[model samples]
Target: MRFFNTEGPVRPTDHYSLPPLERWDLNEILTFIEQKKYFLLHAPRQTGKTTCLLALMDHLNRTGLYRACYANIEGAQAAREDVERGMAIICSVLARSAQHYLQDSRLNNWVRADGALVPAGDRLFQLLEYWAAADARPAVLLLDEVDALVGDTLISLLRQVRAGYTQRPNGFPQTLILCGVRDLRDYRIHGSSERDPITGGSAFNIKAKSLRLDDFSAAEVRTLLLRHTAETGQVFTSEALDRVWDLTQGQPWLVNTLAYRACFELPEGRDRTRPITLALIDQAKEALILERVTHLDQLAYKLREPRVRHVIEPMLAGTALGDVPDDDIQYLLDLGLLRQGNGGLTIANPIYREVLPRTLAFTPQASLPQIYPTWLNADGSLNPTALLEAFLAFWRQHGEPLLRSAPYHEIAPHLVLMAFLHRVVNGGGTLEREYAIGMGRMDLCLRYGAVTLGMELKVWRDGAPDPLTEGLIQLDGYLAGLGLSSGWLVIFDRRADQPPMAERTASSTTVSPHGRSIELVRA
Candidate 1:
């Protein structure tokens, strides 16, 4: 009775999996370790860094090449300032891990030499030295969740590891691998007095190489799903696989979560033998997003951090921040929040693109009832005039209220409008949204059966002139890209002179180049 695991480390006897070791390029990692080199291994949270490290440790230990052990140092994060307390926790965890893996009490004994754990700031290196001396074979150490330690404690840990690098293969651990959600180069240690403020100095430069574990590839995701089918005789339809890939973009946790939910949690007596379908996948996606599970919730919290804002705001505006630091972009990329595309940055996947704006608009009223409906006709056609009139009225009455209450106040007007549109057509239609930090425009495409409506939303500052002409051109281009003849240009006129709807003549319909028509609606 095996099942897909979406939680912590997968055990061999459990309904677990080991994504083919052959599929990953671990030779470089092995070579680095064999050469007694220290390095960093990082990727987005829950992307299997711990699993991979554990597997690698098993391989190394079983091959009789090295004595390997994995320990998480996150517990030391709280005792950051009290170096002594942090070191004691680190020593205790390392001892426990060694006792579990090596089945040898000697490793633990050495760590707790003379019935006393070494004091903070000194325990980690001392334990490493003792273990290297006590072990018959060279040792490989994997430090998981290294980034969880913050401020001075993190700096102390890194510095100690760097200090002990020279004694490797003899008095120190033969190889060290620091695993976390960020690469070492991106480490922004704040309370360190030894490093220069402007240019982060070399507090710890022992890293010989930095390896990033990437998301599952399309083929790999298929193989993972097929493994379950082979075991349980349950099948996944092709369209289901396509939808899963589209929604999760091969995020490992998401893929496993969806599969687990599909096979185990779906309503009973459904069509289980017909192979899962795209609609099922969509259902699971919606459920997960609505649940705001741990992974998604953690990512949402990061949105409030200034570093995330620096990258996301520009992408939302449809503009680029040319002078942005590489580390800032890299941090977001490592978090699975952004992806590299077209030689520039883009939302990592479609699900993120949809979730980012909606999540940013978190508020009780943002999810309020929509007085307007999404469909214009009974035949799944859009009624542009009705849609515009409803939006205009809604905007005039509650537009200010919604904007003022949005979580991301800067993008409140735009998101509130989208929320209104989403509520209206959510049942019968689909809205494809694309916006990123620093990008100046939010492009949206409304799909209603056979007809597609494209729109570009923008906001004008108080002193800036009207953006209708520019918005129309942009909307026309967007429409043409979608092979549509006409669309709407919705602008939030924040300028002081902008009058109410009744007094506003600027909000009207017009035709642009190549006979492309646009209705400029002001809120």
Candidate 2:
């Protein structure tokens, strides 16, 4: 039976999937190919660009309108700056693809006969020229993972494509599509010599348009889940379906992974008589995050990149963007880590918002010093007073030293605190975070059994006024949202003039303007 596919391209016969061509503007794509245009198709990793391109290739070839072929040049990335080796691999892959997809063997013969005669920079151009000439039908070439080529190799490929721009239909492929994780214009090609860095737009100036493949829509997400019901007679409750949409925001791989885990991997869910519920979906999400599966793991690995950090750090700390470059913001958007909407820029979806901070706190969480479970009562529920006391004691002894271990210095205190809280929630509770650009504070809610603890974290930096009043107000609002009467407002004073951790850290009881009880913690 077909199942949700998390790895590689989705085949309809083997996987539950949407129609590929329906994901984009098919009429516009057809027009571009008919006009012999060179363009780009880009999206974040695992968003189905390759799947769509392959389907498009099939559609074109089936029409008998063009000799279409799809080739992935990712195998050449290992050559790095070695243009000759990279180009050779690309040409060979293309030749094999032509044979497999079009029943055309002339490209293979041409590569054997003329491969060495052409210069490294002109090899791709020559191969396409020969293939287009050998066939009466115009050629449509789909080059997947085009950005995987590095440095001078990438430069050479783009320039070669640009070099062959004018000779289409007969002398070169009538339509060439470059597909990658980012738009070609975002590439910064650096050579091995003293020459300056080159922009991809300068190298591939002939590109007529660039299109991005979006995540599935909410309706599509529902349709996919219902397909399983149609086939297996096991249904997803309305709330379960809504939960899936909320968590995944229609990210293709995430949707498939969650559904697969809930319906197939979990023993309780394996019974075809059982219906999927929201709790099961939440359990799957928690398991997915804990496993750090390949997609989420790769995303976590990208947090260390300077450009990514430049945009992410401030967002995590709930501070103003503070002069971040537009390119850095755009890069995050292109990566599908952030989205812009009427609510403004936020992490793309709820799952990503949860993942980023947890990923950052991972090291600190693993290395936390020994502390007794004083917060756990004999009955197994959490004790708020004991939890606070335990945190204060932990902070007094090891907070300063542990702060140094945080991944981002600007948000060190936040990560260190989260590391401690993660220990409290460990196996039986949930820690939820809500922070965003211009929010000026990070709000957290810890739910353990029947008890809920709301919190608001504010950083009191130099040149900024005391955040106590603002934080209390924010905490009051947050507590109301959680239907709680009291919570904690933590203010981390980061001013250079402040005393050391042990001397300055303290807590006191207060009241919000709305009469809710507040535990004011200043550290």
The CA lDDT at 357 in model 1 is 75
TM-score of each: 0.89, 0.97
lDDT of 2 by residue, 214-300 (tens): 999999999998889999999999999999999999999999999999999998778989999999999999999989998999899
- Per-residue lDDT, model 1, residue 266, is 79
Error of 2 at 337 (Å): 0.6
Local distance difference test values of all predictions, in order: 0.77, 0.90
Report RMSD (Å) for each prediction in the order shown: 3.4, 1.7
Which pairs clash (backbone N, Cα, C closer than 3 Å) in model 2?
none
lDDT of 1 by residue, 1-523 (tens): 6777798876666654655355468888888987899888888987888888888889898899799999998888888677777777788888999889988687577766742645566677877888888867998999998877767677778878888889988899989999999776645676543133422765567778788888888988898888878876778889998888888888889888988877778773134566777777777777777678888888888888777877787677666666777777888998988888775778887777877776776572455555756437776577777777777777766776677677666677777877777776665666778776554689888776677788888888776677776777777777888998888887777666657644452368789766887887766
